[model samples]
Target: MSKLSKLSLITLFFWIVKIVATTLGETAGDLLSMTLNVGCAVSSTILIGVFLANLVTRLLSKSCN
Candidate 1:
């Protein structure tokens, strides 16, 4: 018997998108807190709220399947 791999093109695309988005988010966060003088606490709170809102929206949305 041979083992089969489960990874597909769609999965690979999503993984790439996730990595890029995470890197972008981190860079933006650093810029906001450091360059813009927004302060870590304020920037974090704003970002966290945005993240939670997106999470809830995605969770409530219907699945493609």
Candidate 2:
């Protein structure tokens, strides 16, 4: 396969994976807050922690590069 084709296929696969993961996360979040009674406040705090961790990792990676 050509390099372009391979790269395109990889990109498409990554996009599909991202979509599936996002959907699963949303569903799980609702289930936690509604069914498990986790509450929006706790969920939001957890999500904020995740966001901060991701932001820090991205900043560190970019600086390293």
* Clash count list over all predictions: 0, 0
**1-65: candidate 1 lDDT, tens digit per residue:** 22323456667889999999999889979988999999999989888998999999889989943
Error of 1 at 9 (Å): 4.8
lDDT of 1: 0.86
- Per-residue error at 44 for model 2, in Å? 4.4
- Taken over the whole model, the C-alpha lDDT of each candidate is 0.86, 0.86
Q: Which residues of candidate 1, in runs, are more than 4 Å off?
A: 1-5, 8-15, 63-65
Q: Model 2: residues >4 Å from true position, as ranges?
A: 44-65
